[model samples]
Target: TICGLFGFELDNFERAEVQKATRRLLEHEKRFLERGLRNFLIYKDMFLKSVYRAGLPEILIYLPIIESGCSPRARSRAGAVGLWQLMPSTAYDYHLRIDYWVDERKDPVKSTEAALKYLKRLFGYYGNWELALAAYNAGPANINRAIAMGKTRDYWILRKRGVLSRETSWYIPRFYAIVRIAENPAEFDLNIENAGKKFTFQVLELEKSLSIRELCRRAGIPYSEIRFLNPELRRAITPPGRRYNLKIPAGSLAPFLSAYHGIKKEYIEDVAVYTVRSGDTIGEIAERFGTSPSLIKLINGLRGSLIYAGQELVIPVKEGGLINKVPIRNNFRNYSSLISSSIRYTIRRGDTLWDIAKRYRIEMEVLLALNGIGYNEVLMPGNEILIPVNPLLSP
Candidate 1:
């Protein structure tokens, strides 16, 4: 394989390991891998330009392929986010905004720039691409400690010494494997399609915060399209009281500006702040506000359905009896039969019925009906409850 003959030579053990990892990735996630490659191709120009401008090698473009499969919204279990998989602290260090209204780590262009800057620093510290790549996965301190203990800066040596975490140990090889296969898809018998047009957008500076749905309406585009263009925006509304750069479809800026100015001032204030009280859950608050729990979490930066007392959340409310315009699919109606074939969920510490309902993406009313529990029922740890099995809901 080209990977074994490339910039970093692989020993027999390493070659076999790389081949095994490549095979596993190809066999188990071929479609997803192909989609990732397609996504990479879509942003190839952006990646190349960003890397070249940073004075980094073009191969660095493949980093996001391994980090996030080219998905801007990718988030890891450890709270690392975006295509570059930057943790919150690293993102903050890079000056990427992470707040209630937006998480800039999920912005494709901004995060790519931030990641390139960070990678350059890592490379300068290590003086070797392999070591720098390893440090990118594990912290620099960990890599430095490993180099000190192993008395060598070679990443392979550290891997052999078992000085890196299992994930970090495989990171370099996996990256190499992805690069090799991507560089020579035919050699690996893989078929990757073009991702059509390159992603292009124009930034419109907004004087006041506007509901994303309203922006979409004025732009004559679907809400989903605007959301796709601006993945960094976490809420239905943009943050208030500041000039925010809003990305819209190319050439639609003039139309958007004209339509935006025509909107009524009252409709712009569509969001309401609600302070969470004791026994409050995201689902209950969402229900009260005529919004969805998922939207609340997105707006407030809540990772899961968990909400604590005294936490203030931004909730989108209906305007003039018009339904909340965020176009989330109406899946609540499907919950009645969905819960008929259910599974047991053990109540954990601080568990609430609303938490369980939100986690499973079911209506709280349906959850109450399933377990014959009341709306205000108090839940205790270790109590087993019936939870609906919905494939559409994320576990």
Candidate 2:
């Protein structure tokens, strides 16, 4: 009867197993499970509507309960992320942008749409709801292999044969239990509250890069509220070189637009650039700049932590109007004397005085003074410059 009501029928044995699991879940993890269920209730209307629009079953909304505990920021040990727990590769395959700046996986609307498309494709491949669900948990390749090895396409048969992981084995039953409980929470002594107001927002396309803090300050929006809406942004600031779709509270778009225009360009600071040194790493650079590795990766558009010597990276400094402060090693007298022993050096692509000084073990001040260059002077490739190399050091 429960299966028929849900538009999917399970045998009596399967029903008994599902009920047993549901009872166990309710007994031990009720409070913990209720928190996730409550979160789902907040967005239930949005989720169900989206799923129905995608021509998927409304019950699909319950998938996130098990996948992410209804948390948008959920990330798995296997690198799955967001409400639907999408793996990076899977997200990318589905055209969900997973850059350092905006991981669309964290966006509920975007991730849910992507998840639906993925689910539809899995259903098409398996041609069975249960098999599709299994494929979704363990991947189609794993399920295909299991089907081949077990000589059966039945999800339960494959599970019984131990061809599927224990987690995959229970995934469907857990999903079913959640669906049943959600259909009638009152039966389980659960009290679900209506999401007071539907989560609503307006997207403001940013013309230029700005920090979230500055955006909130200018628009008079709460920092926590703005951040909560755009959890995908890895850094405090929106990334440069593209129009970022910034989500703002509903009814605040007009104020935000007016204030954003009034804000001076200088008030929106540029990210500091740091050229990598021989012994530099993303972690070390982050430490030096008082930022995070994720922020560095985001600003620099790096997918990984591999950085080579002389690579320029954008440093994610939270504070504005801050200069890059490289430590001056030598005294003024020693620095002045050190400039006397100079060698003619040609600037390469992306070369800076900071990098040159670090490379030659000379003070940056001495390098600037020796070359008659200003601190803000742009260095061009093939430009000849004098480097004050130490007598004991080789260039």
The backbone clash count of each candidate, in order, is 0, 0
Clashing pairs in 2: none
TM-score of every candidate relative to the true structure: 0.68, 0.67
Please list the residue runs of candidate 2 whose C-alpha ends up more than 4 Å from where it truly belongs after superposition: 1-7, 10-14, 194-197, 265-313, 316-395
Q: Listing every candidate in turn, what is its Cα RMSD in Å to the true structure after a full C-alpha superposition?
A: 12.4, 16.0
Q: Which stretches of candidate 1 lie over 4 Å from their true place?
A: 1-14, 194-197, 265-273, 276-395
Give the worst 10-residue stretch by lDDT in candidate 1. Answer: 327-336
